[model samples]
Target: SAVISQKPSRDICQRGTSLTIQCQVDSQVTMMFWYRQQPGQSLTLIATANQGSEATYESGFVIDKFPISRPNLTFSTLTVSNMSPEDSSIYLCSVTGTGEWEQYFGPGTRLTVT
Candidate 1:
């Protein structure tokens, strides 16, 4: 099993600004994922962060908008390149199948854009 942590539990950002959230794991993990859960919406996969390699983003997400970095097996970061009201959502970092395909999520970084 792996334990994950995310920085800035909540934040209010101005439109056009950006925020980078950090994710850390207690144990080495092969794949770390980033997800977004908007108000009253289901979770959506943003990208898969792999150590020493580029992150693989899912559809509708581009590296330019949601850039990710995984410096090692246990740490990763996701940067929201630009801010907008539409970007106001809960961003979470997750790890899959460390022991169980079920993924575990961070408390989440709630970003509000105004």
Candidate 2:
């Protein structure tokens, strides 16, 4: 099992600004992913962060818009580039559980853009 922590539980930012959220895991995880949950919406996979490689983003997400960095096996960061009010959402860091397809999520960084 892995324990994950995310920075900035909540924040309010102006449009066109950027925010970088950090994710730290207690143990090395085989799979780490970033997700976004908008108001009244289901979670959506933003990207997968694999150590020593560029993050693989899902459809509708580009590296230019959501840059991810995994410096090591237990740590990663996601930066929201060129923010906007439309970007307001909860960014969650999740990791696949040991030997299971289930994922554990962090408390999440809730961002409100205005």
Candidate 3:
């Protein structure tokens, strides 16, 4: 199993600003994903970050709004651009090993845009 941690466990930001959350994995991972969970909603996948390639954003999520970066196999970043109150959600970083089907998630970054 891989251990994952996210920076800025929680934060409060003003509307229209942006926040960048970082995810670090103790071991190299084959797959990394970014997800958002609203106040009363299920987890929604934002994008899949692959090493040395562009991130693939899910439906309703565009690169301009939720940009992702995978510098290598163990680190990635997700930036919420031009955030609004509606963007306030818990952002989680999930990962799976090279041959594993089980996915592990980080503690998550809680963002509250006011």
Candidate 4:
């Protein structure tokens, strides 16, 4: 199992601003993914990070709005660009190890756009 941690466990930001959240894993993993969870909603996958390659985004998510970086196997970052009130949600980082089907998730970063 990999241990995951996220920076800025919670934050309050003004509308029109952006926030970059970082996710760190103790061990190298096969795949890293970013997800968004709104109040009273299930997790929505934002993107999948592949080391040394451009992140692959899910439906309704664009690279311009949610750019992701996977510099290495154990680290990644997700930036919420031009954030608005609608962007206020909990962002999570999850990873699956080599040959493992289970995904381990980080504590998550809570963002509130005013």
The candidate, 1 or 3, that scores higher on TM-score is: 3
Residue 17 in candidate 3, Cα distance off native in Å: 0.8
Off by over 4 Å in 2: none
Global lDDT of each candidate:
0.91, 0.93, 0.94, 0.93
Model 4 TM-score is: 0.96
| lDDT by residue for model 1 (7-103), tens | 9899999999989999998888888999999999999999999898899999999999999999998889999977899999999999886465888
The TM-scores, one per candidate, come to 0.95, 0.97, 0.96, 0.96
For all predictions, the C-alpha RMSD in Å is 1.0, 0.8, 1.0, 0.9
Q: Show where candidate 4 strays beyond 4 Å.
A: none
Clashing pairs in 4: none
Worst window of 10 by summed lDDT in candidate 4: 96-105
Candidate 3 structure quality by residue, lDDT tens digits, 4-114: 999989999998899999999999886899999999999999998989999999999999999898999999999999999999999999998655777899999999999
